[model samples]
Target: MWPRGDDDIIRSNSLHESWSTGALNIDMLFPTDYFLFQVAVCSALLSAVSPLRPAYSTALENALRNELFVDRNYSLLQRPSQQVDVRVSLTLLTVNELNVKDQFLSESGYLSFSWQDSRLSWSNTSATSQDYSNIDSLFSTELYVWTPALIIENSIQDMSVISDTKIPMRITQDGWVFWSPSGVYKVSCESDITYYPMDTQTCYLKISTWGYSKSEIGLSLEIGTPVDDSFYRENGEWDLLSVAGHPPIVNARKGTWYSSLGFSVTLRRKPIFHVINTLFPVILMGFLIPMVYKLPTDSGEKMGYCLTVLLAYAVYLTLISDDIPSTSKTVCLLSVYLGLTLTFSTVSVNIVIYILYAHFEGDKEVPAWIDNGVRKFGRFTRREKRDQNKVKPSTKEEHCDDKKLTAILENEENNNEEHKPITYREYSDILNTFFFVLYMAAMIILTIIFLLPLLINYLTNG
Candidate 1:
């Protein structure tokens, strides 16, 4: 057949006459059929788009259709055997986000997995999809393969849906299965804060089937080797101690068994940062307790200094309390120690008040108790006591010649010098010296008794 030219195609052949000059002419291209040409081009484009796939390969498609693709609707456990035994394993990528304050740990990892479905199997002798990669080289036709819907049972409370996938999976003729799924999950963990800031915790990752119980789909864990050091990256916040998964546990509810696997993730907190930021400052402020007694009441800063230190302690307590839950089952040991220090600080303030009052008692005769108490606790030697008690004559040779005396007065008739009154300054000096020694002794005893034990435990175990 000859190709039809545009002239052979239909076009308007009309004679046109100019109205003004009355000249006759013939036009051929007028009223051309562009609508017909447009329909022809569209038909060509549609034919290119929907190319014939392997489904149209009647020999292969018929082979697979007879042997493999017949069963689209059947029971979930499509097996000749009574039970579908499915074993699951895991390959960890990382554990990135751990929120101690929220009591949940976020894990990013995938499942190393396989399963069996006998219904979707056939002979692979005469097929293009014999090899796994060959299935890709063939036309875009993967037999719709259904996979199990698994889930994490012990995940965070806020999660409404469990982490999983729903895409159609693969099925081999030999009934071997393979699928790997990765996700980031926040598993709930209850931390023990008995030694907290220096504490170790064990969090669990649990896996189980979402709908089916063990009677339908039996679950098993292949706990081959414990987690290696290189399995997870080193975290600045925690040190991974060991990862262990226990044997499958069977749970029976309403006369049916449910199977699941439990993995324990053991970790110890890196506490050097906690020690420096939260603990050292508290301890340093506590040591200043001794200086409160040593400050002379005359300077009027002794009370003010004590209150300021107390206020600082209050701020530290507030900061720590915000980090640690008030409703926690186990309280931190550092918090306990801080509470004890605050108690001691309050006692010091009381002691300061009493001493200041006694020192300023004006012109009252020195009580006998005061003299005995000063001598007993103030470290005055026997010679010093005797010299203090003796009367000195007006004559220079009879007196203990201490020229540091600020004042001297003479009697009118006998020209004898009067003895000076005992001053508040003198009593304050004696009290300050005595209490400084007392506070130091108490601090040493408390350190040995209360604080050392905790420090030793951390050194041995941390």
Candidate 2:
């Protein structure tokens, strides 16, 4: 019913129809149609390529061995031997979006990436779908070939580049790529964000990719909102993302990147200590020196020793100030020392005044008005009473004789005693050297406890 060439075509058409229609009659009439049709197709292919069979067979075997046809189903009729070239590339971009949730501090920025496949289309003269698909395969198979770099740029003069050389990039089914170089970044202070001296301004991060591809290379950056975690990292590790880069410039400055990730830190001014050391010892010692005034003036060591403490405090003040910074805001513990020293000097001055007054006035009993008002209100009641009471009256008549006469006699006696002052040896037993030693000990202890902490806080914080 059909010609020879038409017979093969008719047979192929009938077989296809029976297969598609699932005909029960074909199963009985042509039980071997599927097998026969496959044989006929193989015979025709072999006859048509018989002259180049060897060349074609070798090429087909090479392609299969090379895994070029792994995605195709193979049959005896026709063997595919075509191979495509896949090209790939990766690019990194810097992201500059502010993170609103955070105060622009912790987790301030991260790396992100954009991936593109060039093997989606096949072409020799120009890139085709096959070329894109092949390029994508390279990405899928060689996920470890990608690396990321972060480029930081801002309005400030100092911009730093943060790099994590150990990035591992992997492509997902949808062609999205991801990676992260975990760490916090330190951005320079900005003035526009806040007026405070230490206010942190705007900062951003970008994600990028690095790799060895030519055609299929691409990168994308996502701008992150500013955040505030300036103190420390909330999570132990940096979050994972793609290509990371710095945000846009808010205020630029000269900057370099240091490899610390825990917190953003800054330096403060150091505290001065010279004044504190000098004054504290003097004041503490000075307070106790007044106690020495309680001793009789006849005691040779009282004034001399008090004078020595005053001089020592002055010397300490001068020495300590040399080491302190002139512009420091905090009052040095040394200043406290100096204050104490000056206070003791004042006490010494009081002692000197008391001794001079005692020596020049003689043992005349003080006048009732002088005793009740001036001496009592002037902070010298005890000394005045003791000095005036030492001399005895000759008689009741002499004591009551004209009050003026008594006063004159007392003055003459006080002047005579001043003219014949007591020697240091005669009053040595009355002097208490132990009080001076105790004063020094208290000062040392107080300095150690109070001054040390202030100094430590100043130095550490500052």
Candidate 3:
């Protein structure tokens, strides 16, 4: 009689029935139920000889056939039979050609991957059906949606890339697609039989594709290694090995596969020759104006010329603001040049006013009362006209006698001497001296306030 348990009856019937009958009945029973009973009996008989079996013979055979398998789906079969865990590694190669759409606004580069595997599973342990759809869309490709944990290591040091082969890439209506001469492969078991097997086995997958017209690219690998609680116990640290290849010539850096490869681009203003051409002349003009102050103020034309330069600098300052970014902190050299020009122009104005005033007003003698008080303190004083008048000839009595002397002196002077009138040239000389002294003083004060502070600030910041 058949055993009481349905499972025992299935197993016994499978062993005793003819092959044709059993094959026909196999579909009637649940495949898992039949496989479980067979596995129990097989475990008892094959435990001693199981170690002798090849570690990855079926997996290697699949690899030779250009077929790849992952461990996730296979785990369900192994779990019922309590089989040993298995691990496998695969390598993939991809070549990419890129074309940048906007060279001024964007840049282009290529990505090459050396090793890629299909066994690694994602870390979304609590993923719901919605989460799975989201993640699948994120990493889906035109040919297949690989649920593998991709590890990327960037060998490019100077440049950065956006995606590697094993990235969470998604397909959109306008999204990138992968094309291969060999058709794409889907998930499958390593066994030649159509039914899932209870035996434990590991498989490796190698995928190769080229990414063209890409903004940036990188390389990475995937594996079936599970990340447990201990994996996250410490900081998530991963060590990645790099395959053989020369580093990219562009701005690149050596990076590890433990983290995702990332890239970001910014639009920068290109250095324009026309902009420099426009600015260079303006800055030169501003600097040149300060030198005009060195011309002697006696030239009389200095003030008019300096005013014209100051106006030009102001106009240039207005124009420059349109080109440079508003948030830039750098004080333009042009601004400094314009400031110096304006300051010197102000000094020029002061000098012109001073000279014009001194020209009109000659030095006036201090009043007698003020002079007397000043002299009491023992300060030096100029001789007053009153003091000179006091020394006039006291001999009025000799006036009559002097009158005869004066008449004879007048007669001799009229015959031998001619009188010359005095010129205002002395006043002009005095005005020049005073105005120059004032100019020197103003310059000294400006230097103390503006130049010294600038020097101190520069040195401290530097």
Candidate 4:
């Protein structure tokens, strides 16, 4: 019935099961070769052709290599009869530095430019007509520049952008090439730092074609929305108020006239940081000079405090000098204030020396004129100072005992009574009160002289 014994038993069982259940288990009898044949046929049909296409970047490069020409303006490098009027605009990304001393500006931005190439133009070659134009990769091609002689004038250094665009510059069917390159430019600019931290400064960026005259190369800046507000970034110390561009330059050099497009940037300095760090502390120290005179001459700290304040002002002056531009033509207002206060400080030191000298007089009565002058300043009595400074006055018993001792001394030395006039302690009180009044007056005058003009200026400006 069957070739093998197991097959013969299985075939009989299957036939019985089929008659009993009307169902067949045919997989148990299928041959391995037949299964393999079916798999092979399916695999061949599925893998008949590849679904991939050529890469876009490669196709764009091929299109550029095949069509666009970039070397056509070389013959007229020396004597050019015709020139392309290129339209240009700039989008600021960063303002690196506006050097006041060096007279230059460093900037980074994207330069948007559009120009027509006669050789690259196509008519009826719109996006629908060209198959490659429909594909985005075909437009990403390295265009050949026919005119390498064309260059930017008034560019001090490094006009070319650091990072070039990888996406090939697209050219419309009408021969318009819209190209934007990211560039870093350093242009020479004139600045006036007269007011410095509070000053508003204006710098200019000029662009023009080099080696080509007005008739050969015509340059015009874009008009609408000239400075891209969204693209501009913030500066740390300066606020950009406005940026305006126009063609305002007609420079003559070596018997040739050159025209240029000018971009003026108006900026104001943010002075809060400098005021807090360098100016406020110095002003506080200047106001503290009066405290030196308030100390009694015996404390011996009046000169020390005066000198310390003077030295502090000196240090601040040095600090500010190192940062600002080194020019004597325009001196800062803060410097003048420091100089005046420094003079007052020097005078204060001398006044302290005089007070110490007068306070130590040995049994010499102060002259009538000095006493009269002291009275005119109003009485700066020892009682008032002792009470105000919180210094305790000697008890009443101490003065009574001193008077008794002096009476006994006078009785013993009656022969020298006519020569002796007043004690040193009494003389000191008179002089101290007079000079103290004078020192306070000086402080008030100095403060008013320094601050009045500044206040007036602020109110007037506002």
Candidate 5:
């Protein structure tokens, strides 16, 4: 009734001293004052002993106790009914890893299941009479009640019914039970790496009633959005595009119908890391394949350059092999592009060796094909140059003088000025130019065919 402070303690101490010295009279104090004094003494004693402890509300406790006691004999082994519908939803938290080679995906999330149990129902009037009107729900461990055993149908882990005693179930007054348990799930996913680094994968998380048939336990998503990603952690290698839930599939076996619900998760590969580590280097090496022709045949580095690029491609192919599963159902276009580039490099090396032989150990007369090709190429080039330069053609007198000069040079076999015929060395030069244009064009075409889709997807999706 009154604020107790240092003043109260001083007053009490003074009274005690007076009483001890016989200087105070109890008759002088009023009945109200005497009662107040007694109250102050008790307060002081209690404060000296320990601080006041907080009292908890018993409504929630009583509700939980009553619910658990009533369901103490509830058999978790039995189904609630022959037609219990369980609404299941998923909350995706993390995309830990998706092993392409193992064909399995690892993820951590929560599975929420809600259904009605007729035996667990109670009246609101009873709860209100028990002083638990504010407490609308009671919680009990999952092991204490019957639960629809929903198992991951495509799980690669132990195919057991999900049970976590530590996780509790929420039960309302109207027998509606809601249970949500979180765990790491590893499920089988058939990976299609046809586009590889720039590929988009659609993985599914399939759920089914383990022991109960469709007639006993049916699954559905009452909510519009069944798969939630509000708490999803971003994965470094893959970008989650969309998550969609599908209705349970009804299949009949031996006159028994079963149901399975699937959640489709579409994930696109993040091309930046793979591009820098694998694709960029492979493309860079591909460009080097055509550069082999630019080197002069006499430089003796042409063959070496081709072989070096070819070896680099071989190493890249081996590296890619580790990332993708070995299956012949479908081949990756990236691998095919690399194989084609490698083949071009090998053919270039062979052609170079042949050119070298022709240049060093061939006869004086050039091959007819080479000669004709060279002459035609020269004529086309000279004609273009002449047109571009706007130069006048040679006159009749000049033509006659050129003919007489050519005859004199042909007749003089012992002349000191020796006239050299077109040789294989010239042919090698022409072939080098031809090969340069050919392989560079091939590289460009291969890049467009293989990597262009990746670029388009990355840009469009990102």
Candidate 6:
């Protein structure tokens, strides 16, 4: 008889009743056979009503682990094959910062690396009677498995190999291994600041197999989009234009070939920030430079005004210079514009000094050439006004009065043989008017030449 515990007392009583009710005929079996049948029936019923036993997941994992890695000699430094082809892909997460002055790009992302290992492959029931066919994959780490050593080719930060034993690597039943590791990566990039705030920069994130030759471990991108930006967050100061992956490039050095894959991130400056903060002010000051001549000489702010504008241009140039690398390979157009405007301000200051000297030179006779030029310009303007006002005389009386006035003017001109010379004040006034118009025209032309292209680019591409 099977031993019964207090927990099975109720079940035993129910079974006795079922037997007494003739559910099983006692005469149909012999005494020993009935006892054996009772034991068999009770065992089956207990098993059917009992709670489920623990699964064989841990056992299957232990078996698979022992079969695959226990004695497989999977060395981290060793490749699975002499020529293992690694499939590499990148997914961009965030464009943290791009330092134009330092010529570097900082970003956060992960890399998906996949390759096959023939040694780790196994059938579903290789180690036990239980069918582990439901198990699709297994997990391991770099500590106990062989993984390709891939690294950023142009990294500026940590140059060490990527290895984290804590991160689990997925291994499939068919020996396919997939590993994804993520971190912040910084890479060297060439900055082209020619258009400056209106520029579009393409920076590359390059990857390579470290310590492995191109023949030892080939690198290829997956067939789909290799550089995925589906999870990208927009940068406030920059707009992402495109992200593209390039085919593997075979590079040779010192009689050795290395394989590298590249992904290009094209970004354009948002321009609104720079336009309001930098370019707009520079332009506004360019126009303000001509106003120095408009201020009265006696107001005592002529020199101060000119110096103030020169100082403003200097400050703006310094500010913009901080954003670009100090490289001679390319010069920013905005810098050139600022320099030219600064020079114009300097010229205006010198002109102010000269004008003050003329104003203080009391009663000085203007030179013959100066007096003649000023008088000729003044007379030409007056003559044009007179012609516009003149009209034909309609009455005989008006004609006689016009003839009389003409005769009197001719006699007065003949009598005044020697006229007074031009004064210093008049010469100063002439110089002021001429330079005001000249400077205004110059400022407008400079805006059109240096700044129009920037505006056009901003409008077209913003």
What TM-score fits each model? 0.67, 0.31, 0.30, 0.63, 0.75, 0.77
Model 2 lDDT tens row, 1-462? 323467666766776777688763444334356566668879999987653323334444344223332343223222111211121212222222222222232333433333422221122313211222222321222222322233433213224444454555554433344444444443333222111111123333322222212122222223342222333333221121222233321221234222111112222221123234433444455455546645555656666766776777677667655544353333555456566656756655674555546544554444454333432222322212225424455676474768877686667655654444333221222122333445556556755755566556544443
Instruction: Give me the runs in candidate 5 sitting further than 4 Å from their true place.
Output: 1-73, 124-134, 252-255, 369-421, 460-462
Question: Please, what are the lDDT tens digits per residue for candidate 1 over residues 291-397?
Answer: 88767677889888888887888788878877664546987777787777787788878878876876676445455666555545444421112134343455664
Better of 2 and 4 by TM-score: 4
Q: Write the per-residue lDDT of candidate 5 for residues 1-462, one digit (tens) a residue.
A: 556679777776777788889887665444667887789889999988754532336755664456545534566776777789999898999888888888888999989899998666654444432333345677888767888877888999968887788998998877899999999999998998888888888889998887788888999985776889999999998999988899889867688888788888888888778888888889988999888877876788877888888898888888898988988887888889888988998898898888787667544668666565566564332211111222233575356676775665434421321223356665666677777888999999989888777778667766
For candidate 4, give the lDDT: 0.61
Residue 442 lDDT in model 6? 96
Error of 5 at 320 (Å): 1.1
CA lDDT, every prediction?
0.62, 0.39, 0.35, 0.61, 0.77, 0.79
**Per-prediction tally of clashes:** 0, 83, 13, 6, 0, 0
Candidate with more favorable, higher lDDT: 4 or 6: 6
Determine which window of 10 residues in candidate 3 has minimal summed lDDT: 192-201
lDDT of 2: 0.39
Better of 1 and 6 by lDDT: 6
Question: Over the stretch 1-462, how does candidate 4's per-residue lDDT look in tens digits?
Answer: 225578767766775676478674545443543475579768887767432333446655455436543333322233322666666677887788887767678887866666666555544343222334433321433334333122344467855422254645666655666666666778876666555446666777776556666666666776575567577889997777777777635667698876567677777767688668865687678778767756776777877887888888788778766656777766666677777778877887787677677777755767766555544442334323212222233575366676776665545443342333434555566555655666667767766775565556433333
Model 4, position 268: C-alpha lDDT score: 71
Write down the lDDT that model 5 would get.
0.77
Question: 52, model 1: CA deviation in Å?
Answer: 29
Residues 251-347 of candidate 6: C-alpha lDDT, one tens digit per residue: 8878899888988988888877888998888989999888877788778888888898899888888888888899999888888898899999989
